[model samples]
Target: MATANTLERIFSVDYKSKIQPIVSLCIGGWGLENLSEPNEVTIDNSTGNIYVADSGNNCVKVFDCDGKIMFKFGDKEGKGKMYRPIGLAICRDRILISQSRNCILNYQVNGEFVSSIGKLGKGELEFINPLGLTFDESNGEVYICDYNDNRIQILSQELTYKAQFGQDNLHSPLDVKLTKEYIYILDGSNPCFHLYDYNLILHKSVISREHKLQVFIPFFFFIDNSNNILIITDYYSIAFLNSQLELIHRIPITQPNGVTVDNRGRVIVVCDGGEHHLNIF
Candidate 1:
């Protein structure tokens, strides 16, 4: 892995030259080809298929690498029904969706229903409003941001409860992402980012206001292969940070909600407002 200094030097080049629009997808609408208030996105690293949590439409949309519509799942009334799905994460062969209904729904990559867990509560294995989903590929564990619970819940790939942490420090955690060594969380209430270790030890907290950035509030974020942190802010911009949590660059965007990087190092952003389309760069 390259050091933070190296990554910073590499990203210091011209912004337009370093990143440019590569693809835009799903004009705003309720149709299958369009998206309404998409919340989160993730790439199937093995197949390069993109999975989007189409919240307003109450479904999940899958697209190929070229932004071609593959298929969509989640019905309003069915065995795999969904209600305002918000977060998404892909494990080995399953798709985990966190919805406002206070539960996490599990499905196969082919849209087959596997199982669902959680309900409205603060007890073990229960959630108030689940938001972000992230899978630890190394341990086959899934980390869920329990929104109202103010903590992160860990579950096995099989949907069984494992362990949880962060209630003492986090305030309305909106999203959680795990790299090989550290856990990154975006707190909507504190409007900051928290860094934790594998053992759930708090290392540091980054306040957006104190950073001297124009960010209003951070909604979601992604850590790329090189450990670069890409955060989508409510102020219509994305803030780039190095591994050491130093600001690298800030780019203009439109109502960005979720963000992720593809295997090819392309930055994919989900714009929930305005165009309600995805911008790939």
Candidate 2:
């Protein structure tokens, strides 16, 4: 929780110098090679390729920097089958997808199935509804937001369960983002963001309404290289926060669910409602 003085310090700064991120490129539609109800988006910084968890299409779509479809994997009824992939992350040369079936599927960079990671349960090595995940390049570990379980599960680079935290405070944790010094979580039920140290110690909690922001039910978020936080909300806008967690700007879109920053520091958003396309800013 934040004190009144803390809130005052956060809101005292002028946020009038708004950032206007134009839609430089809009890719995909409702057909094949297009995106439908995409839930998550990640960038391979090394290759500058974009990977989208195309939930409705039951596959992961990869596109080049120019919005050209490179390849897609995960069929409806065959090998590497996935149902409603809602979470995606890039771990070095491997890709991890968390589907609605309550398990994380591992794949190679070239779209080859490696193995299944977890199952449907509440015990160790299990998950109820894994939503958003991120790979920590500093430590080679995977952090997954176990939605229904109300916890953040830690896994090794090999996808083996290591530890879990946040069950006592997080309510419907939707997304997890990692910075070198902290771990950030977006909780849908609480409709707030929680900041924690790498040791899993809760440092602060921020509610959008407390700061006079119009963010309603943040669905997912991404932390950029500069430590700026870009949050996708159900209210048809993306809220931007500075490294100090101050509300800085808000970019309006249709209905965005996922957001990420590219290697070039461009903001990429995935609009799932009424606009099934990727908007690059």
Output the number of the lDDT-best candidate. Answer: 1
Compose the digit string of candidate 2's lDDT tens values, residues 93-203: 888899999998889878889788888999987999999988876566888999999999999866788999999889999988776567888888858888898778998
lDDT of 1 by residue, 74-152 (tens): 9667547899899998877888899888888889988888777888899888998899878877667888999898999
TM-score of 1: 0.90
The lDDT of each candidate is: 0.78, 0.76
Pairs in clash, predicted candidate 1: none
True-structure Cα RMSD, model 1:
3.9
